[model samples]
Target chain A: MLSFYICLRKIPPMTEPRINPNVSVDCVIFSFEDDGLEVLLIERNAGQNRIEDDLLALPGNLIYEDETLDAAANRVLRELTGLKNIYLEQVYTFGDPARINKQKDQDWLHSIRAHPEARVITVAYTSLVKKSNFKISPSSFARQAMWVKVKEVPQLAFDHNALLEKALEYLKHKIYIEPLGYELLPERFTLAQLQKLYEAILDDHFDKRNFRRKVLRTSFIIPLNEKQKGVAHKPAGLYRFDKSKFHKI
Target chain B: MLSFYICLRKIPPMTEPRINPNVSVDCVIFSFEDDGLEVLLIERNAGQNRIEDDLLALPGNLIYEDETLDAAANRVLRELTGLKNIYLEQVYTFGDPARINKQKDQDWLHSIRAHPEARVITVAYTSLVKKSNFKISPSSFARQAMWVKVKEVPQLAFDHNALLEKALEYLKHKIYIEPLGYELLPERFTLAQLQKLYEAILDDHFDKRNFRRKVLRTSFIIPLNEKQKGVAHKPAGLYRFDKSKFHKI
Candidate 1:
């Protein structure tokens, strides 16, 4: 039986067809902060029956028919989290007819979707944002939007857990090639902080001395004249990324 | 407005729903040979009207609802080309609503698909195949399956040209990171052949002496005892990739 009556945001007038029931978009939004690597999740609210109510899922919804995939991703993120202009990269598409065959999933979809039995193909995306950049407040059908550490995330709704795993794998591989870790940090940060970010994502420890030596050699990681303040121990020098230098290299 | 009625292969009986109209899979199969890097394309056959019927496209079709995205990609490749076990990598998913909104495209879809107006989201894959490994025979709706040099390809159907561009960019970036170019070569190849493969993919020339010197320094490329057979010029030494050595590094 359906446990919740999830109401999606009403669509505005569009020149093209209203919405494509067969296609949806999901996002694995990641942020780095005091809790290490964290991912944004939405807790689906309960209804009168209140059965199996604590379902957590990535912020996602069916895409509007007129919008492109990227636009759909952005709109979904904004509607669920009250955040916009996020840097989202398309990771993979998940399309198995049995994806929603589980009774609980079917029941949940029955409550929300017009066509509950439609085989939805979701285009998944990976997004990175600074922890302090935006405030999150759940909207539409979501009860609450919150950040959970990647390691501590419970079994998510739909195939979201698999999506999260793929996103992490993408991040792991991408970090080695690109300086994407900086997206999670502040404008100015220390080498230790940067190393910690890498360690959290890679789930491994690095020799402090060697890590610093290697990072300093890169033209992008420029050491600023500033230093850390309000620390009980010795202050660490601050650094910033040089985008022009990175592009040149 | 209909031109040619494209007849798809009959589907096997399944417990789940049949083909998902909203989801399709397209392949950008690439092979490196005498004419340089070539991509496999399908030429749609002409009908009685034959109006705008010179359509060329990536070998693709709507995916069965029961199969996963990867399985669908493999199956689509086999159905259209009569080739199996080809290594495929998912490059991207294109879901622009206007993608098939063009008049000719709409006419093409109307002639073939049951729900001609349905928005289709295609998950595109990039495949690498050796030229001499297998033969290609067009099946299903494809009038002809043929390899066209990447440079000589004309405007393709739907958003396939954009998909091909993305695949080419992926190949260019991936060649520098991984030794994927070997998938297009035989067990034994000469240094000159290797250099030519790189040149064709990168669209840039390399100093032969310097390129050979750098290649020789790599642990993975091992020089074989045999040399090229029956060449007008002096026979060159052959080399093979050492997978174990690559993994070790």
Candidate 2:
């Protein structure tokens, strides 16, 4: 008679052939630029299954096994966009089965078929970063990384457009209570610029007097002795975010 | 070469498996009782290879193919607790592989091994319902269902205790803004009862006068011109929630 261990070993192990799928992280990095509130979009190389010669999409990559979700997101951001340590957050999980192969050319479908062992489930996250901080370079996957206005994001593949909309709504809600405006602004920015950022996000005009008073009332802004350059209008006073006061509220 | 019709049928056939094993949903339903905030707990049946005999656990089930996360949550609540149309929201996802088979019971491990098709990844959600509304009935897999005070909940099985703690914290944070207190209170309750509900959830002593003033300031409380009865103390004024103004803020 075989021993229990030997018998168990002899029995064909129930194989989890479905490769837990390669989990990837995608970042819809937003920045308030001179143009408007914009999201970073990267162009993907045109392949046999891709209809467009250069398809545009969000910057993201596959997560490593030994890393946490935040760590994976940070690594993907740095590797893809040369940006590091921004205010990143997990927004939502995208697991629609159709998202894997919705490409017009069926190139991605063929790629997935070629690597049967690769079942990739991507976790989508978003980051609000200062547009001025980084010099982005196109990785091997695309021609270049460019900031596109949020309103102008065109027919993106998969559920990216819906993801972007959710991120924008999250930002609007977050900005009301948290000091999220700092993520879009530089180390020193004028009160007008801050107001403009709010307007752009809320998509509504605010009385400058009321807006200034409300922001100042929060007691989370520091007056920096600086001014904007190359502006013909009256130079507005610069201010920086008071992290200590912001946390107290 | 095969004809076009034959090639179409044979090549790139849609053979994707419909059964997804790695996803499930667990619910933590909290109710406000006369004592304090309570959570619904169930006893797992001592069935084949199920080691958690007579142990307390949250009401949960595997996600179905034709349902959304919210729909699955509603189904679980209705099927397990016999309650419906309550306040429900997704809290977080738990993916720790060791969370399932932490006990070193060979029989339990064998049960899990037997079900090779089951790779459970649970997403936790929390719901708030009036304690009086539920009709407790144990399912085929459970021994019984009972409302256990959150503070008195025993060491639960499968990270359920941790999930309950997280849900309590989420409720505490949400009470300040969202109209979630109504979910726990009876349709008609006194001012003192409302204050006690807040105190129970926040776990902090609030000045009675101040709490009353703050709640009344919202103007979403309708004075029912009724008073508490069968009590050994002063009869407090009864009030009902103004549903139209509940979600205004």
What fraction of the genuine interface contacts, i.e. the true contacts, does candidate 2 reproduce?
Answer: 0.00
Cα RMSD (angstroms) for every candidate in the order listed: 7.8, 9.2
Regions of candidate 1 where Cα sits further than 4 Å from its true position: A1-17, A46-49, B1-17, B46-48, B207-210, B213-220, B242-249
Kindly provide the TM-score of model 2 when superposed on the true structure, using C-alpha atoms.
0.79
Error of 1 at A244 (Å): 3.4
Residue B177 in candidate 1 has what lDDT?
A: 74
lDDT tens readout by residue for model 1, B96-211: 98898877777777777788899888999997889789799878767789999999999988988999999998898678777765798898998888899999888899999999
DockQ of each: 0.66, 0.11
> Which CAPRI quality tier does the interface of model 2 achieve?
incorrect
- Each candidate's interface RMSD (Å, one decimal) is 1.2, 4.0
Which pairs of residues clash in candidate 2, taking residues 3 or more apart in a chain or in different chains?
A21-A119, A49-A107
Top of the candidates by lDDT: 1
Task: Return the interface RMSD of model 1.
Answer: 1.2
Q: What is the TM-score of chain B in candidate 2?
A: 0.83
